[model samples]
Target: MSDKEELYCIPSRYRKTENLHIVFWLVKDLCWVMLWKPLGLIMIIPTLGAALLITWQTRAIKSELLHNVAVVFWITANAYWMLSEFYSTDDSLRYYAVIPFSLGIITIGYYYLGLFSKKVR
Candidate 1:
């Protein structure tokens, strides 16, 4: 087995799909941020789709469990932020949105630090 396959255990095909999904996800977020008013939050649709695809790709590899969970948390965070942006009339929902957002960030950081930071031995 190749070194990467030994570490990640995911097929190259799924890895490529995951990489593409991540790229699309970032682009979607960029669009959402740049055109928030003019796009009227429509970018979330594609972002959500990309997030879902990423989560799905993570499912094939057991080593990616934490990353999968982080992606799920990210999706929840995005949902909360979207709700706060489009539907909330009070400050409470906006405040609530921060919880998931922070958790998502922490979890993503944990996943990267715990997994990606380790050198192959």
Candidate 2:
């Protein structure tokens, strides 16, 4: 750390929401791990909703926005995977979780590439 180093700060309100979002996400996953089908199914609402809100709030910050958007996709994939396990008559739908998972990877890749390009200039 140095005096010349740049600092990035998020508003307390946003931070609080982000913290609460973690709780929601954890609860969702815990429900999944515990195999509480009905409660787990319902937890996706707040989990995904908070991810969306975080993405929207950080839209002005390109790097943050990119990461947050990926989080949204991650949650989507997680929820889909959980649902597949819960509602499936067979074990096939879980394989499709790759779709959203891949999207999250691509989003992160794009962010790193963009950062690298900026440094190259």
User: Which candidate number has the best TM-score?
Assistant: 2
Worst 10 residues of 1 by lDDT: 31-40
lDDT (0 to 1) per candidate: 0.64, 0.95
* Over 4 Å off, model 2: none
lDDT of 2 by residue, 1-121 (tens): 9999989999999999899999999999999999999999899999999999999999999999999999998999999999999889778879899999999999999999989999999
Which residue segments of model 1 deviate by more than 4 Å? 1-5, 35-40, 86-89, 102-121
Model 2 C-alpha lDDT versus the unseen true structure: 0.95
Can you write out model 1's per-residue Cα lDDT over 47-121, one digit (the tens) per residue?
566666666767665446566666767766765665576666776776676677778678778766766767642
Model 1 accuracy (lDDT, Cα)? 0.64
- In terms of lDDT, which candidate is strongest? 2
Given candidate 2, what's the lDDT at residue 78? 97
In candidate 1, which residue pairs clash? Answer: none
